[model samples]
Target: MQNKKRLMRVLGGGALYAATFFFDFDNEILNIAMFLLGYFIIGGDIVWKAVKNILRGQVFDENFLMFIATIGAFAIGDYEEAVGVMLFFQVGELFQSYAVDQSRKSIAGLMDIRPDYANLRRGSEIVKVDPDEVMVGDEIIVKTGEKIPLDAIVIEGESMVDTSSLTGESVPREVTVGSELLSGCVNINGVLTARVTKEFGDSTVSKILDLVENASNKKSNSENFITKFARYYTPGVVILAVLLAVVPPLMYSDQEFTKWLVRALTFLVISCPCALVISIPLSFFGGIGGASKLGVLVKGSNYLEALAQTEIVVFDKTGTLTKGVFNVQEIHSEVMSREELIELTAYAENYSNHPISLSLKRAYGKAIDNAAITNVKELPGHGVQAFVHGKEVLAGNYKLMKKMKIAYFKGEIMGTVVHVAVGGEYVGYIVIADEIKNDAAIAIQDLKTEKVKQTVMLTGDSKSIGEHVAKKLGLDKAYTELLPADKVEKLEELFAKKTEKGKLVFVGDGVNDAPVLARADIGIAMGGVGSDAAIEAADVVIMTDEPSKIATAIRASKKTLSIVKQNIVFALGVKGIVLVLGAMGIANMWTAVFADVGVSVIAILNAMRVLNTQSIHNSTVPAWEGNVEALSNA
Candidate 1:
């Protein structure tokens, strides 16, 4: 409604200005009145704001500069030029408001993910209430097409959830009993009843909204410089304009005060600084909005700037480069058959809930008979000991075999090895490995194509496993057997190796990785919704676990920075050249208006280019994927 009123005022002022050109009113008083009516219509707010600012001792703003220049033009009998300057300046202001609104729309669209209400299930009755009113441990019923109101564990029903809002992937994720469901996902297929695990304030959607809302407060260095530049630049130009007007008439008796005053007003019009003040911040804001469209949440422009300068990208092995879930890869036996070996290992590991043990049981794919198993004991960092069918069974690492005085053969394998022993005799070993993510290799290649100097992996896994995965992915270096503290120590070493202006980025997806994530120059958390600690500590969050998005983020940041630099250079370059011409009277008030307003419009349009990120996302595939495919064909 306010915009509509402003638009009407601009149109009315513009119509009056057009009248003077077409119809000639020879009466000077009548012509001046008509022009004054037009000027006050569009520029009244600006003049009023300048008055208020002056009263408060906050003078020399863009409003004050525009008011002084246009009012001076009226005083010099250039009525048309005075009103035309205000008309064009208002047009430029309108364009800036529109560009900022468009950028905001990209992020505002995500606000729909916040659930309006939740269906609370209490015994035989279901009641609807605000999502914030629903407490943890309450059972919530999510109907088909309803957004999940809070983080929960599914207790009944199965459905496909549309996680595109949170993960960016369009594929629907299947959920069943015992599956964890995050807030903001839509229940696409079936009704589901889940026990709420978190309150609305701590849910994924709430945190994401908070992160995005506060993102603009953390400005880049370029934005800070522009703010400071404008602070000093505006007052300095105003003082210079005063000197140009007063000193010239005092120095030369023949110099007319009105002629020099016109030049001073033109100088003030050219020196508004609107182009630099508006376009630089808009460029960064547009870039951030574009990134959010691709499901990448950059916490601030400062982080975006740092991401563009990343030289070394360090990664955690588990849940980062590789799927943290283990799978049984291979099995070898001497005294027992393969099936017998797996069966015994599965039964021995039945009581343990470790990922390695779970993989063994999953590979076994058979129900265990508790009557046949007895006296199970799990040793930390080793393995499990139990009796199956009256035979003593020891299933663990090679250390367990040596502790039992049983000779065992260590196989040449790139995985975690669990050795099996029967009645103090070595039987066989089972190899369990964490599978590498599909895009891990392509991600590494993309980073290299971006000219990253080093790509390193830090892992708590054994050396053999870490080196094998690193070699497969073509990483520059891999440090294995690292604890959480050791990963931080290694990051410091890598940090020292980076160029002074370059940054080190660490990517991880675990609670233990929070320290390293916070320590790095820029930390990116993968599968951000799955880990609260990672999301809290990371500077940027990749909604999906895809490593390729790292390259995508870098590309976005670099493009945004490029646009910002272009605006800075283009705005200043044109303004600088024209300001000199205006002072020497080579440029008229018309040219001065273009130098101030026209340059601002052009810079704003250039800044809007950052919001069109479809091309950036389309080019996110790393260059290595194509080269490797070509080599294979040869």
Candidate 2:
């Protein structure tokens, strides 16, 4: 609607200006009247803004430059040129407004995830309320196609959920009984009863919305430089225009006053810095929107700029490179079959609530009969002992087997092992380890392709396990057996290895990693649905919990920076050339108009390329590969 009004005004002014060209009016007063009417019709708002700014002590802006240049053209009897310059400038402003609106729509699509209403389940009744009114622990009913109002646990029913708005993955995830559901995912084809776990203010959707809304407040260094450059550049050009108009006419008798004044007007028209002022920030804004489409949330443009210059990328092992879920990977048995050994170990470790015991129970995948088991005893550092079917079964580490005088074979495995013995005979062992993420190796390989200097991992696991994972992923360095404090200390040591302009990035997803996340140059937290410590500490959040998205963020950042540099060079290059020609009276008002408005429109169109992320997809591994080694503990 606003663009329509602006178009109508420009057309009205252009029609009046064309009338003066074809219809010859003999009276000079009548021709001047027609030209003045057309000029004010197209540029009335700009004239009003210049007046308001001058009253507020804000002088020498783009509005002031346009007002002085066009009015001076009319004073020199170039009425058609004055009207044409204002008409073309208005056309440029229209294009700028439309481009900014399109860029905003790309980002505003993320705001559609904010839920408007939640269906609260009252006593034998359902009531609708705002999402903020919904409290923690309240039972909410989500019908088909309704967004989950808050983070919740599914208590009944089942459905396939559309997580594209949150995770950027098109495939719907299955949610059944006891499944955790995140806010902003739409429920498809089922009615679900869920218990809300967090209030709306603290939900995943709220945090992401807050992050996106405030992202523009933190400007990049390029944006800051452009702002400061315009502040002094505008006033300095105004002074040069005054000297061009006044000194050239007074010093040389042969120089006509009107000719030098016309040259001054052209110089002022060419000096407006609209392209740098508008397009640089828009480029960063489009970059942030592009990253969100890939399921990566950058909190600020400053962080996005820093990501492109990252030299070292450090990772926390558990819940970052690995799945952080304990699983039974292998079972080796000699005395009895694998099934019998697993069943007896599951019974022996049943009464214990440790993760290793749970993994064994999960491996068994059957109902345990407590009536057949008796005299269960748990050692502090060892495993457990129990009597299964009137036979003594011992399940523990190698220390327990050695204490029981059971000869056992300790193999070279890079995981936690559970040894078993039945009736004083050696049985097989079960290897339990946290599984590595499916894309973990691909993530490391992608980082190397991006030319990152070092890829490192920090873990609390033992040396052998860390070295195994490091070698599998082809990392440059691995620090093992580090506590939370030790991880920070190692990070500090790695910080000294980067160049002065380079930045270090830390990625983690646990409460223990909060301090290290806050201390790094760019802290990326995996799983937006993860712990509160990780969410609050990170500068960037990857919603999909995939380590590969870090490389995607870097790719997007570099693209945005490339566009910014292009706009700066292109805008200044054209304006610099025309400004010199205008000062020498070689460039006319039409040429000055192209240097200002034409360059602005082109720069804004170039900045819009940052929002196109189809080319920034997952990169394949390169033909050349790095050697796999645990290079340093640091």
Q: Which segments of model 2 are wrong by more than 4 Å?
A: 373-375, 389-392, 402-405, 423-425, 528-531, 622-634
lDDT of 1 by residue, 434-502 (tens): 777778888898899888999999999888778877887899999999999999899988988998999
The regions of model 1 sitting more than 4 angstroms off are 22-27, 110-112, 618-634
**lDDT, model 1:** 0.86
Q: In lDDT terms, which candidate is top?
A: 2
Error of 1 at 344 (Å): 1.6
Model 1 residue 465 CA deviation (Å) reads 1.7
Question: RMSD for each model, in Å, please?
Answer: 3.1, 3.2
What residue pairs are clashing in model 2?
Answer: none
TM-score of 2: 0.94
Error of 2 at 606 (Å): 0.5
Q: Return the TM-score for each candidate structure.
A: 0.94, 0.94
